[model samples]
Target: MMALYNGDEKDIREFFRVYCNFFKEQGYDVVTFEACIGMIMPGAGALGDSRVIPVIQEEDDFRNYPWDDIPELYFKEYSKYFRALREEMPEGMKAIGGVGNGIFECVQDLTSFQGLCYIAADDEELYHNLFKK
Candidate 1:
């Protein structure tokens, strides 16, 4: 997986610059997401701007990408990503998902407040359609 490094913090243009600078400062080779994006598209406006260029061609793994299937591929993709991130963490950050991290809260993020409530209220039809399932 690739990560966007925006300076020492999170800013757009500074990202590429910092990456290149990092290579020069360290006097070592570095593989950057910019290069990946460039290989993906030379004129990509931004890494996250999917409208213009796709950073990850795996649409099934994308969060907002709509699908005709009820169980979107993103659910599995995100679950794997989440589990991997959790498992790979260094001791201090290790923790298990509980109460606040349950399916309802996550579904709420996919569906807005009212949408989530409506779904939880047993309106499966409305919930399915509203969430693009």
Candidate 2:
């Protein structure tokens, strides 16, 4: 899956062309594609379960985190893949995908699952606010 994110425009196009064919061979008219948003997060590897430390451990950590730039970061990192999928899809086939993980997963990626649970128990507001953001 990470392979789809590398290379220049021509490489991306070739990747998607082959990907779309793979789905077709499986007797499907649609292909699934998703960009991992967690990769764009400030400190991320937890999403891939690398056991790295969490980025948000306390209120100050959350406050200092760059909450506003995720979208741009995502586009910068993955928009080309989406464009390639669009341009390379076979005429009768379509692709369905968006960001790889949902809010809960993203939160857990930022704060370890245990840490999030602790926050929920100790700082209910912050726990809820994490989801709100």
Best by TM-score: 2
RMSD of each: 13.9, 1.7
Model 2 misses residue 77 by how many Å?
Answer: 0.5
TM-score, every prediction: 0.23, 0.89
Per-residue alpha-carbon lDDT of model 2 for 1-133, expressed as tens digits?
Answer: 7666568899899998898989989999899999878878988655457478889888888899999999999999888889888988888988888898899889989988888889999998889889999
Off by over 4 Å in 2: 47-51
Give the whole-model CA lDDT for all candidates, comma-separated: 0.36, 0.86
Instruction: Score candidate 1 by TM-score against the native.
Output: 0.23
Model 1: CA > 4 A from native: 1-100, 119-122, 126-133
**Model 2 per-residue lDDT at 3:** 68
Residue-by-residue lDDT tens digits, candidate 1, 18-86: 544555465544322211212222222222332443322222323343434423443432344343333
